[model samples]
Target: MQRITSFFRFCRGRAKLKRRAAAMGFMNHHHQTAISSGQEGIKTVGVDNHNLCDFSSNSDLCICIVTWNMNGKVSYEDLAELVGSSRKFDLLVVGLQEVPRDNILRLLQAALEETHIVLGKAIMQSLQLYVFGPKNSDLLVKVELQVDKHSVGGFGGLIRRKKGAVAIRINYKGFRMVFITCHLSAHASKVEERNCQCKHISHSLFSKNWNPYAKPAHITVWLGDLNYRIQGIDTHPARNLIQKDLHGTLTSNDQLLQEAERGHIFNGYCEGTLTFKPTYKYNVGSSKYDTSYKVRVPAWTDRILFKIEDAKKINATLRFYESMDDIYSSDHKPVKAHLCLKLNKLLSA
Candidate 1:
């Protein structure tokens, strides 16, 4: 019995050694794969060098943006050029309001090396939107990539029955990050409901129990067409109305104001600009509408907001790239943030 027990133990030790050896061999194989295929084999489980998070030490910054109500005329080719022309952000998040079909989304996915998409709520035939991101070249190389979804409460009213929101998560360069795309209620009366929805989203994120803003790990970026504007205490009437409605809520009017004041949430286009551009407008050129001479008006309804931790990493001169000149893409202009994540330095001790 003693001899038999000794023999079993020896066998078990040998088996463990064999397993370790096999794992090492697999890793070596993947390294060679990465070298030969570039980004194609970077998604393998044991591979560590090719992920976006593992970007070159010199590549410290990432750029992102959000646009809403891009009318149906914007094409994937146009969007790619816009992104390429911009600061080459590591990730791009766009909240597309009124994306009539998946054509543009599909085109973007193809144009970008590695892309992900999350479809937002569709209101009427013309009011569909989506969030897109994590433009890494290696994401498509691996067969193990998985995409998941999280839904948030949207503008609930007669005109828009279900204003939905969705989140997308991806693993890049050894870190995982989350991006949320939201389109809140547009109706002036649903301010309270929209506040509740935002609270729910906050709760859900906390429930995940993951601090995306922390160092050496994942980062969370909450961006989209928040449908809220950040301005002075004596600013636009629309801003005042929103403040009045949420004066005594649990979230607090001060907290909301502080978010904008402290730079926790930034308005990409409002910092230096004096005028408000309305993202939603009547398309005069469309054959469906009359071609009579009428004044074209714009509103600053569509906007991009981000958390303080993420905002701190950006350059001070960030602004919206308004030179695409494609009026047909959507009524809303896309806003971008040029950020360089200094990986060489640590955010914490």
Candidate 2:
């Protein structure tokens, strides 16, 4: 009897593997299949949301998105290493905060030249959202920009500091996506305020334009220095947990997750599992956490989140999610996320 039971278990496991293999094979077929390609050479169009719900649909659209807070310092040194490997992703989205607006934009344009990627949208100040795609790729077009800057810090929300967010929407082979990068309120005790900021930013992005597709974007991406912290623990305990490489355990008290569970912010967005050390409050040029009079507890304040409509119709696969400690110009190390996306049979059909 025991032998028969073991035989059945092995058979079941083999069947599951076969099913997974078949599903993956189907996805690869769509990714490799070319649905459309634009005219060759660099093509820059004005921000136009007038041409959505009318583009042809085909092929897999792979996207890579990176978000960082420069702390008023931008490094062109590890720009290539920032995204690590492209893996032939069709699109690249960069969201930034506290950066040199003009020079950083120029740096991106120059650095991207090596990869032969061209800008899809112009760079905005401080809070920046940039779109890049394969040169001469016509699969993604009809790009549009909507920027909303609401001061949440400094001088009673009057100055342009820790601002709201910047967003850019584009249609890729009939896929609609709105990419937004924002810098919310800081400090540990301001969780409610951060939640409010999130609500405000969400409303601003979805309501900035009159176009229906423009407002209620199909796939919305929110990434930046969100400033969420670990709560219900003293600074020393948090630091000790981080020192012991127990970052995963510390996330139980993450303010952002708590807010989401309470249905107060980012109700439907999903975040990839964070497997890296805390990315904030680091000493410049050192792996050690802040060692000053104000010993700030290390936290994963810098993060990336995503929201989607018709979840059954599309799939998001996270290839990697971690921080870049090598690029050490700011107190908060830059964090990165790589995502491989696919459309379902209904969308493809």
Candidate 3:
């Protein structure tokens, strides 16, 4: 009888413990939820302020916008007008793949009011030797080149060249950020090469390698005319030709997306948004090619990507303007992301 009573007591004790554990779990969950709600509310308030007004008061906040392959063909007057129309962007980091010289860049700087230029290795070398010549090349000498400083890793028999990537660091409102503009090898045979380039960029941004210029505290943005698309299937004539045997491995977007999924990076346009229109068409005299044909253009070659932490602060309904009337600027449409920096929390923290 005593044994049975003891067994009953043990069972009752077990039941009580279970109930207490469950209650504790519920309380903990509730506490976490409340804390998360409070943090979100605070963040929302900060974002609201950033969006509603200029960030002049919060000098610690910096806004960056990038447009790639803005070859010299795009006039400064038109570029200025386009930038002027943007609502709340402060710093513009343009990755001009085929910029001819400093003349056009200087004109753009003058027109944009508060702007600077950072030339890529290819552009710098080409312009130094061709445009400015040896005598007047001291100004372009200060533009740092990352490709020369970093080594790319990949399979055997792959081509590795620094000609593909260019970067510029922006100092704004007491905060600093790096903008890397890259144009990878476009050949279908260069899948391994593109992969190597992606790995190089990933390591450069995340690795603990020491460089006075390349520090981790500053946010990094890898944006430009990537040339490769992340789409599962090819729809454009140019892409169809490239997709025959490579099986989409040649695309930097594919590699970047994979890394992003692993919580390494983030893409701003992953939510069914288009960054570039079919800005390229042969001038066939009388009538331009049907603009509707652009719908069939496969892959988003031009894109913007930021670090994961930066993405967490982004509001869901960020605007990407694609329907502007200025068609003569370049062969690619300029992509913009309206990011609101949470200055109050950052400052408080």
Question: Which stretches in model 3 have alpha-carbon errors above 4 Å?
Answer: 1-64, 85-88, 114-162, 187-191, 202-215, 230-272, 275-297, 308-325, 344-349
Each candidate: how many clashes? 16, 1, 0
Candidate 2 to truth, TM = 0.76
Q: Which of the predicted structures, 2 or 3, would earn the higher TM-score when compared with the native?
A: 2
Arrange candidates by TM-score, descending: 2, 3, 1
Candidate 3 matches the true fold with a TM-score of 0.53
Tens-place lDDT digits, model 1, residues 63-176? 455555554466666667645643345556554554554566556656654444432222233243333444345544432222233344333333332343555555444434
Q: Which one is best on TM-score?
A: 2
For model 3, where is the 10-residue window of minimal lDDT?
Answer: 126-135
lDDT of each: 0.42, 0.67, 0.42
Q: Estimate TM-scores for all models.
A: 0.51, 0.76, 0.53
What lDDT tens digits, residue by residue, belong to model 3 across residues 222-290?
665555544334445444444363423334345344333333233222322332343222222211322
Best by lDDT: 2
Q: In candidate 2, which residue pairs get closer than 3 Å at backbone N, Cα or C atoms, i.e. clash?
A: 38-138
